[model samples]
Target chain A: MRIGELSRRTGVPVPTIKYYLREGLVPHGERTSPNQARYDEAHVHRVRLVRALTEVGGLSIAAARDVLALMHEPGRGRLGSIGKVHFAVQAARQPHTDEPSESSVARTNDLIEQRGWHVRPTNPARAALAGVLDYFTRLGQPDVLGLLDDYADAAEKLAVAEIDTLGGRDVDHMAEHVVMMTVLGGALLNALRGLAQESAASAKMT
Target chain B: MRIGELSRRTGVPVPTIKYYLREGLVPHGERTSPNQARYDEAHVHRVRLVRALTEVGGLSIAAARDVLALMHEPGRGRLGSIGKVHFAVQAARQPHTDEPSESSVARTNDLIEQRGWHVRPTNPARAALAGVLDYFTRLGQPDVLGLLDDYADAAEKLAVAEIDTLGGRDVDHMAEHVVMMTVLGGALLNALRGLAQESAASAKMT
Candidate 1:
């Protein structure tokens, strides 16, 4: 298929496809002639993945590129690759200057210890969780902090279920699955939470 | 305090504060003279809320303004106000031209019915969940659909806890709390899930 067909199939514009190609988001198509190139099923799949990452997952182009590169890198353990992809997705959003507060960090560490979660000390999510805890305190809604354990409990269960689904998958499949589930799965859970909140509020508030 | 002091107190720059004022994301200060306006503690709080909504929640300026306006609207029941805020935030991100597929909508309805939820049919989250269901199918990951119930289960428990915390709060406080929790709480949960996934993957992957 030509670039035009790739654009049509993926619903992405030709110029955007060219831009993605140039940015190394999608690999170059085979040069069929001086002015023509041919894409394949892999290109179509890659384009769709890129769109999902950038459009639905809200990852920046650079972050998406890094994720793709990590997916293709050889010799890293599956856990290491998953960790790197998760860190890459999050690191793009955090500014280096905005450090988490000490109290928030202590609170996050307390939650981790209480849960007995085996997360690395340097997991970006440790800082991300602390940042949110700081925001809750700054917003004067420390009462909400009481529910942190509940959230963590649910997160543990969900994560267990998520990993169980990855059983027996190869490294490449596992990496892609983790990235999609980490990003798109977040969106799915968020949307489900919104619906559940509506139902709960209606039943309780009225 | 003037706009400069408001900026200093919130750590938002003067020009960005001015822009928020112009965008109606923050209430205007009282004009003390032709060229001078005085802000107050409320202004500081509003600026911080605005920054949190846009910066942390990833809401657009217009969406943030709509959320703030809804917070101030009179006579809306607490549940109604929360529903409106959630709808406004999600609606801002969804383009009107895109509609969820019928199968996805049916799946969402099935999940709600199975959960015995009392959500209104018009809840934006209904469509949002359907859209994500569509994405999972489109991505050729229908196996993930098996986890929908687990996600919904967690969402339900979290929502119950969230609404329980709102007990006895007045409508105004409830509205703000719902908005913050809906947005920032989602972030918190996402971060926690990331951490949990890291631990789970480590234990199960190797």
Candidate 2:
């Protein structure tokens, strides 16, 4: 199929599809001629995944590229399926920390594990920002690092509640919103937490 | 109070407080002498808000600046208190869309009224992301917008369930986690939705 058919089938525009191709998100289609390229079912699958990440997951192209990289790894399983979300959330958690090292992420993970917490390795969110933990740690702010486990523990319940929340919607709408909320809602959670901290200070007076 | 006393109270370092002042996040303290700056309760409040926005909200300085602009307004009781959250959530719906015009947002409210979809503005997340509707309309995409609302409705139910799931931790931790989940959980929600989409597709094939 040409790009138009792929766009019609995927609900993405031809120009945007071309952009994704240029970005190397979707794999190169087999060229039937010097000017024509042919797409297949794999292209269709990749396009849907791309939509899920960009439109629904709210990832930037670069971030989406990282996610696709991990997804392309052999035998990633359900672990790979959920990895990008994890890396995204981790990036959201410590955005200013900048590029962290593998050891720093490992250190934070170790700290969280020491506190008896559970976080999925395959989560793409952690993978994407895998660098920030080290950078932030180098800043010598242990307070944020200390909160990692508690953050994860809090996150685990929210994830379950979020899934449970999906139960009542029409299946089609439910699926898309679930993905959107997962990304957008995660940001809201952080805002709510900040306000709660302020409220706590005010509440102390009472 | 002296800077030392303020530091003792807030557990924030003197240098960090000075940085906050330089950044214009906190108002300057009264200068007692050539070298002395005397702070007060107002400084304390402002500093706390700044720290909360940085650490907990994970907002970039510019993003935090935009949010604080709405917050420091005297009329925050109405606009600042909750409406800001609503607006922020809406503004935040799409990662890459530019800051929208007031008229564009108004146009969205008109669409919601036209659709006659049952929703509430009681809370921002509850009624937030009407900006998403406009984006969808402009893009000629309803399936995605419809899914966003559906996700919100589901999340409302899950919020209640999550509260129940919090089987009596300290109030601060509970509140913190609630906030954390609000943001992080949304990302997880997206992953779930995508997985569901994949499942649905696979089922059709099978």
Candidate 3:
């Protein structure tokens, strides 16, 4: 397919596709002649994935690039690729925490230890969790702290299911699945929560 | 205390506080004289909530203003306020959906009916969920659709607990709590899921 056909099929503009080509987000199509390149089925899939991450998942261009890198990795073993993809996606979503609170850090460590989950203290999620707790502590909202265990329990159930689903995908497709699950999964959870709250609130208040 | 003390206590800058005052996100402090105003403890607390909504919750200034308006409503009953806060907070977070898919909307309505969840199709969350489902439909990833029930169960549990907590707070505090829970709760849930996924991925992959 020519770039225009690719654009028409995928609903992305030709200029945007060209920009993605320059950014290496999508691979260069085979050149049939000067100013004419042919994109294949794989290119269509890649373009769709890139669009999903950027437009719907709200990942930045650089973050989407990092995610795309996972899908293209050729040298690593399956588990190694999984670990790397997970780390990259988590790191991309995590806020930079240069000044983490020691108390929140201690609490996060304790939660990890208490759960006996195989997560490292240096994991970006730990820092992200600690940051939220630190914000709560600063805001004097101690009551909100009590909900952590419940939230973790729910997260664990979903996380386990998410990891289990990854086992069924082909190695080539695993990175995209993980990226989508990690990023869009948050959106899904939030939307579900909104619906549920409406239900609960209606049941209680009405 | 004066504005400077409020700034120092909340760690928000005096100029930002002034901006909040001008924006009416925070109530105007009583003027002591022509050039000086007296701020009390309430100002300090309001500043913290405003910062929390903007910085951690990632709400826009206008969204934050809507949330503050909920907190300031004086005549509405508790249940009415709860309903309003829920609507406003959901409205603020909902992504603009221009051309919603009919199938996804049907699925969202079916899911709501299946669960007997008291959510309207017109609710912002219903649109948000429909949008996500529509994205999945376009991407041809129907497998992700299977996880909705699990996500909803967790959300229902959390939402019930959330509304229960709201029952204990005064009417003014209820709005702040709802906004914080709706917005910051998302940050918290995302962070926790990140940690849980790390744990799950490690256990499975390692």
Predicted structure with the largest lDDT when compared to the true one: 1
* TM-score per candidate, chains pooled: 0.93, 0.47, 0.88
lDDT of 2 by residue, B1-206 (tens): 99988887666789988887777777788999999999988776566555545653345566655665655555544422433443453344334433444765575456445534333443342222433343444433344444444433344434444444334444323333333333333333333333333333333323
lDDT of candidate 1 over B67-122, digit per residue (tens): 88888788556465667777776665432223678998998888899899988877
Q: Give the alpha carbon lDDT tens digit for every residue of A74-137 in model 2.
A: 4543333333433443353333323446685676456445644344454434433343343223
Candidate 2 deviation (Cα RMSD): 10.6
> Candidate 1's residue-wise lDDT over A1-206, tens digit each?
99999998877889999999999999999999998999999998898888778876777798889888887788545466667877777665432224779998998898888888888877888888888887787777866788888899899999999989888677667778877788778878888888898888889856
Residue-level lDDT for B41 in candidate 2: 85
List candidate 1 stretches off by more than 4 Å: A76-79, A93-97, B77-79, B93-98
| Candidates, ranked, DockQ | 1, 3, 2
Give the per-residue lDDT of model 3 (tens digit) for B64-115.
8987787678764466776677777777766544355898889888988898
Worst 10 residues of 1 chain B by lDDT: B90-99
**Per-residue lDDT value at A17 in model 3:** 95
Better of 2 and 3 by TM-score: 3
Error of 3 at A54 (Å): 3.0
- Model 3 TM-score is 0.88
Task: State residue B133's C-alpha deviation in candidate 2, in Å.
Answer: 13
**Quality of candidate 2's docking, in CAPRI categories?**
incorrect
Prediction RMSDs, each to the true structure: 2.3, 10.6, 2.9
TM-score of chain B of 2: 0.48
